[model samples]
Target: MDVSCAFATALDSADNIALAERLGYHRAWVYDTPQQSPDVWMTLALAAERTERIGLGPGVLVPSLRHPMVNAAATATLAALAPGRVAVAFGTGFTGRRAMGYGPIRWSFMESYLRAFRGLLRGDVVEWEGARMRMLHPAGHAPPRPVEVPILVGALGPKGNKVARELGDGLFATLRPPAFMTEHSWVAYLEWGTVLDEGEDTHSEHAREAAGPGWALSLHGAYEFGGPEAVRTLAGGKEWLGVIERSRKQRRHLAVHSGHCVELNAADEAAWYAGGSGTLCEVTLSGTREAIRRKLDDYRARGVTEVVYQPCGPDVQRELERFLEVAKSDES
Candidate 1:
């Protein structure tokens, strides 16, 4: 399994990028959240110049945030700088749009945007205002345009998964199980962290604190119980109720502002973390090194292509080091 680091734009610095590269991480995934962190494109550009072989990309960029033409141009520019070391993962505006105070766009519109974006990247003439625009300089003179850049999709539900399978070169996901990828033959690149050994208490504490309660609750529930019921069960106190109430308020505010109807409740959050249809934790990899290895082996046995590790919490460096140790170990 190839190892990739999740560059938390909010927490990670240039030093983190250097550390990731030194730790033998193949890629650094910068998130696209305006409120959370730095600009993903700029960060990736800088990271490209910083590291030789480490690939850089947006874990998932929102189509609604920028025009397809802009996305195409930016991606093309990045590809020019990094050559074969860039990947673009596109998704319907969820986190990115929410963070930027933009409303969500329809799935159909996202599909159209991706089609146009891919066409532009492939050097095909895209119809814009009754005019044709093609990539001025193609990767090389080849039948398919030799850019060799892979377009990944952030797929969660069946509709998203179907879109990814139909249109994307790979699938980028966080909470979704590995079985979904196996069923579709899409590359499964999961996002989360793993810790092994002890004595890094300060680092672990930092990571946990940085991860926050929501992230920890989600991860704990996902790994332990497989679905929202588990999350609900684990968060059965007033603390969880407070979070649910806050989410409801947020949903109400969202509805008032954007008029987008969304189910908001503890159950809704649970359902989002758990598979919408049912609860299943058959593919979440967490816990100790041996346990995680066994879980990864199961995923590999099921034909999982990749597992991207995103370290969360307060002590990111410590968690990163632990993740590296596991990656370098015999089981990995």
Candidate 2:
């Protein structure tokens, strides 16, 4: 199975990219969230310049968050910088939009947005706000030039999967079984968390943590970061008050069960961190070389073409080293 490294904007330093390249990672993905990370395009450019062969792209970007024209332009620029190595994945942007006070967009509108975005990437003219905009350069030139940047679609359910099959170059999903992609005849990628060590106890603990039930605080923290007053205005007095009450209750329960001292207001933060770490460990091929090889073999049996390893917690450089060692072992 092919292995790639996944990272958020938090770890997109030049040093990190250079190390990942030397370590034999096939790709480096950057998460696109406004409040928590650096700009995706800028980070991709930096990564591309720092690495020679590792493919770079946004793990996924919200189509509804930006106008199609803007996305087309940004993607075109990135593709030019990296030539054949750039790719893009588009999603509905539920969390991102909510963070900006906008409700979730309908799939129909999102589909149209993706169509236009992809069209522009293929050097076709796209209609935007009654004006037609096409790439304005020659075949080999930048901007209007043609570049084969694959577009992957992030789909979590049946309908979304169908759309991905119809429109995307491949499937990009998280927390889903590989069978989902195999059933659709699309190349499958499983997003997993992994560490480089081989301690059986550590791997077992990580597996358990991955299996633990978790809550998705999509609205709470996204809204909180959007702004305190904006959240009040969007959620209103009654709904907002209800969320506050529920959050408090959930926090108390979590604190009691987890044996941690944390305020009700801090529950979202805690859950996010814990879930992130768990996800990193669970999605990756970890443990001893033999154990990791077995895990990868299992995924290959399930028809997974690529497994993206996202390191949890800080210390990204150390994780990259560990991951590189695993990759080198597989090569041998």
Candidate 3:
């Protein structure tokens, strides 16, 4: 399986992407949450200038944030910088939009956007809002027509998967949704967390502190996107919903960030069972090296062609190293 690393949109994203490439990762995925991170395209341009050979792209860019023509232009510009090494994935706004107090873009909008986006990438003149548009560039000055960038769709359920297959070259899935594994295209699974070393305490304060944010994001996504039935099945669904409701009512800042990045109220951390003893296996992989290895194998068996390890902790470099160590040993 191809192993990749995803970075939050921070000041050091290009540096981190360079480090991931230097440390033997096959691909580097950068997030697109503008509120918390830098501009995805600008950050990617830096990544392109810093590295060669490693594939680079946004983890999943939100479509509602920009017009289709603008996205096409930005993507084409990035592809011009990196040429054949660029890959992009589009999603119906999640963290980006949620941070702005909006829900996901309508699925119908995403379907239409992906179609026109793909056509533009292929050098076809496409209609947008009743206007015909195409890239205008001089020969040898910009990336040639049909930039050849692979397009992937970020999806969570069956309907999303259908749209992905219908319009995208592949699917960028998170949490190993079963439907994604069975889909007829490339699948990249984004998993969060760190692997514990032999002497490290898997349940220590440091571990819990590192994992809490990812766990919170997972719970938040489940409640917001998974519908009532899915939320009802969560371990502490009732209490979790209460916390979310209160946060929304209070209008608290809900963007995920670098350290202890849980997007919920700090006080209600316990309500969602985000204490040191909570089970984060539902959102992240925090365990011994061997156990993490087994989980990677399980993901591979489940049809995950690429594993995008999204490091969530204070020392992200250390987390990346630990995961790469295990992934390298799997080949041994």
Among the numbered candidates, top lDDT falls to: 3
Pairs clashing within candidate 1: 206-314, 206-315, 207-313, 207-314, 207-315, 208-313, 208-314, 210-313, 210-314, 211-313
lDDT of 3 by residue, 1-332 (tens): 88998877778888888888888999999887887777988999998999987899987989888888788888888888887888998888777777767778888999989888878877889998999998786786567777778888888778887898788888898754565575645888887776766777545656665665666665566655675456556666656555455555435335221222433344335435534235665467667779888888888777788888877666777878888999889768
Summing lDDT over every window of 10 consecutive residues in candidate 1, give the lowest-scoring window: 255-264
Cα RMSD (Å) between model 3 and the true structure? 2.9
Cα lDDT for residue 39, candidate 1: 81
lDDT score for candidate 2 against the true structure: 0.59
Per-residue accuracy of model 2 over 1-332 as CA lDDT, tens digit each = 56777765654454576677787777777767664566877888888777788888887788766788777778887877887788787766544454444555667776777778878878788887788887676655564555577888777677677778777888776654535767544343634334434444432444323312221222243343454454344322234334444546434322222211101124333443433323333433445666666676666677667777665444566666665566557657
Better of 2 and 3 by TM-score: 3
> Per-model C-alpha lDDT, please?
0.60, 0.59, 0.74
Best by TM-score: 3
Error of 1 at 222 (Å): 10
Name every residue pair that clashes in candidate 3.
9-37
Give, for candidate 2, the lowest lDDT window spanning 10 residues.
255-264
Q: The CA-based lDDT of model 3 is what?
A: 0.74
Task: List candidate 3 stretches off by more than 4 Å.
Answer: 199-201, 226-268, 271-276
* lDDT over C-alpha atoms for residue 51 of model 3: 92
Writing each residue's lDDT as its tens digit, candidate 1 over 1-332 gives: 66677765653455677778887887777777665567888777777777777877887888877777777777877777788888988877555675444556666776777777888877788886467787675345322453557888877678777778777888776654645776655464655544534433312433223332223334333423343344444432223333444546445323221211111234334433443211112222445666557666765676566667766554667777776676657343
